[model samples]
Target: MNFNREDMNIVIVGHVDHGKSTIIGRLLADTNSLPEGKLEQVKERCRRNSKPFEYAFLLDALKDEQEQGITIDAARCFFKTEKRDYIIIDAPGHIEFLKNMVTGASRAEVALLVIDAEEGIKENSKRHGYLLSMLGIKNVVVLINKMDLVNYDEKVFENITKEYTEFLNKIDVEPKCFIPVSGFFGENIVDPSNKMSWYKGQSVLEVLDSFEKEKLPDDKPFRMPVQAVYKFTRDGDNRRIVAGTIETGRVKVGDEVIFYPSGKKSTVKSIEVFNGEARESIGSGYAAGFTLNEQIYIKRGEMAAISGDIKPKVTNRIKVNLFWLGRSPMVKEKEYILKVGTSKVEVKIEEITKVIDASNLNNEVKQQIDRHEVAECILKTDKPIAFDLSHEIAQTSRFVIVDKYEIAGGGIILKELEDEENKAHKENYKWEKSYITLEERAEKFGQKPALICITGKENTRKKAIARALERKLFSDGRRVYFLGINNTLYAEDHNKKEHIKRLSEVSNIMMDSGSILIATASELNRDDIETMEAAVNSKEVIKVWVGENEISEIDEDLFVSKEDTVELAVDKIKSLLQKKNIIFKPF
Candidate 1:
């Protein structure tokens, strides 16, 4: 199998009943690309059914599609031109199968957005245009199809051209050319149309032949996300291969490669290929594997990049421009899976900054994102994932959100959030404790070591309640200590966050001695609790709140009124501790 010409993937997209399939059928018929009896077989079936043979019906092989007269899924047709071989992908134009259209368009290098000249621009016409821009397709050619319905009027062509151009321009897209044609009559498709004598431009075939090949990212920084790590030690051959498709640039043998997030470094020992000649290097668009010189601890989710100045950003939080296609609205509370490159992580919508309607580009202020709505939001993943900015490196930046194992949304990273990881909080610091195990100490003390947090608004008697709880627990023969705010923590530490951190650290020290540490804080939200949780270095913090229900983000184990007596609050805390087996029951 030898090929002299390059392969060009061209996708035809538009609204329903706009003659997209008809145009494709016509292109096949005129170019002599169809199989010997493909057209005749379709025509014979139509004749047997006592139906008229239409160009649109030629591509609709399914009985349902034949009856409905619309394309349901993306259909591929292979044909060759003098310059190159083309794979014409006919994408469905209906709104219901937008995902199918996206799948088709994402694979194409060139697009032909078809429109009905008589019907003019419709809702999907604008939506598909917006999607094309978002899908990163730069080479677009608009076809004002069905000119015969409009009596081949040049004015009709001009009007659609003017209207669609304005819409496309708003989204920063400038089409390469707009051609007037009738797919049914084969006007300006394969041959120059005599009906529209006033128009002079390249025909459909000419424009397609003139289309340039998609540029590979060979000159960019080398980045290959590790898709899988294979160890085929079954045949006494021990070669741990890191497999992935090169997203950009090239990777050669002996190139120093660095894995992100974990910051593991290794050198490429060899380029591994199956049943292929020995290759020195593999460039972008090649799914190649590498055998590292050193067996460093590398994972599938990490990206392999050439160690240099150009590198992907390592962050857990990111700001993105995303489109929601899920049946349910994208809310901040729910967790979704975000897949970028080869990395997949559990993510949540941290914040919704803005929402825009794809049809009209209207800005909407909403907390939740509904289906087909585009939103700018901050998404936080459970762990750090490496990626590039959309504008800087598109291949590594674009991602998709999966809800319930289905791809529900797609997004591009706009900015990386660095503040989340900026607070080191003594990364290398470890607590110095007595040789005796904390669990052993707890057993000896007849109580479990726990950090009991009593939180509420200011002047809610939280400190008094904490002190009472400590006294009650101590009287019950359990070693407990009370740590109040506004004493040594907040006053000595100028920063409020630092004060809360110090309080947590001090509470941890008390718990290390198998003592129940009662601490009082004001207005603790989820993030604050997380900070304390991290500082304490344990999941022993039992949350209890006083006063009105002000914090909705966190679920407290118990809520007590500020008017409650300190003794009653202490009794309630004791009962909760007993229920969790944190304290021993009296015999």
Candidate 2:
């Protein structure tokens, strides 16, 4: 049967042996949703095996599940009510398969948590409840199954409801309703049950139909994690396209867009389609592609968002609520891989704020996160990544952790933290401002402010060229200054890296006064240049290498040979600055 986008995803989760599969099978059978004669085929197979037929057998398609009487993976079954269609995900309830459970539940818009009335609340039941909360599923219905075994006792149902309700509340989950069901007897599943008149509520089918379809995030800001950047040179057609499924809102041709983590800006030139008429705009859920007005360096991992909307946070440090499922416990200072959206980066647990006992709501201070334990912790990535908070946009907020190339944990970002690099930028922005703005200063000085970094190996005459350039510019009625790296050497407990950082900050401050600040540092590699670029205006940082050989992978604006005298080298550098418009050339 064809299903539309309004179809809802509902996940069934509970402890092992909690009749989760049985409930789904009964729902399908009672509603006449099973395939033609598939029910009879299963029944006949049971008879041939000399076994009594169970509703759970209809869904236990795998031989291992039938043998062990437990699900090992998430199974999807489609059913329809008159209101809308549903994709019921039967998530495995075994604790060992909790990761599988997460995978299933993550796709669901609503959840139905099952608990065996005879067995009462199991550890897995509460654990699943906590996971439902963490997974951002707000709509939940608790199903107390096997009420027939308890003789449909109202007292037993009420007691289980009260206890589980209290437990769910601790995790900030308020279940929509509590249902007592007997999949074996088909009571209160599709039809009202005469066996229990004490209960007054809709049946499972009615409850499901009552649920409104989860509204698409079309009203939010446009966000699309670039899945791929395609270049089709076939038949001499040259078009660089950015392609991905929109996670929220819409994008149209001519809209200004910005990519985060790199902060590149561009305009949507045209929308591309396959064998269809070109569209003017596209919204969430469309796997779309577009050409840009300008060629900017955008990779697969960056978030392309509308420039005017709420921007996604870009940072290397973040706080998260995560659960561990690895064989080895998650320890502090150990490296792992964090995958969010299309971006995957090396990550590490900075600190475990606390480990939570999901079954009982107990908190403990721990150095490591054990299997099946939930925790709130700080995570540090090797580089900046773009994402939203869980409260803001959950689609971009969710992440998974891979340990040893295997998925070991999943979580949502609580918030982004200000790392040292970000803090430095923030501090730089708050520096004292003069009444004369930088623009005014630039107009008076007739030169745009810039940081010219002269870098090369030790004993390469970098300082001499920097000083000579400063002298020439000052003599030519220009604002210029030369600072050496060693000036900040003895500043209170600063290391080599910290010294470089200080030099960058000073350059930033000096550049704010509309002066061409020329600085020299020995053996400056790509990283050092990047650090200085981050602290100052990246576009204004002109890198000049004064050596015979290249050291690292640095993008140098000018390369001077050791044989070239300092004066000619200075003249070449000056000509470059004039070409770049950093300084005005003589008329």
Which candidate achieves the best TM-score against the true structure? 2
Please give the range of 10 consecutive residues that has the lowest summed lDDT in model 2.
96-105
- What does candidate 2's lDDT look like per residue over 1-587, in tens digits? 44453578888889888898888888777877666686898899999999999988877653444477653322333566666667775456433233443422236778899999999999989888988898778889999999999999999999999999888888899999999999898999987789999999988888888888878789998999888888878999889899887888999999999988778799999998766777899998777889999876577788999988999999899999998878899998889999888888899989899999877879999999998899999999977899999899888888888898888888889999988765767578686777898788878989999999898888888989999999999998899988888886885765767887889888888887888988888767655765787788789999899887643345578888899899999999999999999998979
Model 1: ten consecutive residues of lowest lDDT:
96-105
Give the lDDT of residue 291 in candidate 2: 95
Q: 1-587 in candidate 1: lDDT tens per residue? A: 02556878877888888989899888877887766677798899999999988878766663345377754222333566677777765457333233443322245688899999999998778877877787677889999999999888989999999988999999998899999999998988888988899999989999898878988999999988888888777879888889988888998998999988656688988898867765889999887798989876566778888988498998888999987888888998899998888788899988899998887889878999988788999999976789989898877887888899888888678999963543343341454658999779877998888888888778888888888787777778888888865563644457766677677767767777788888787887654675676656545788899998643334577888777788888888899998888997777
The RMSD (Cα, Å) of candidate 2 is 6.5
Alpha-carbon RMSD of each model: 13.6, 6.5
- Among the numbered candidates, top lDDT falls to 2
What's the CA error at residue 74 for candidate 2, in Å? Answer: 14
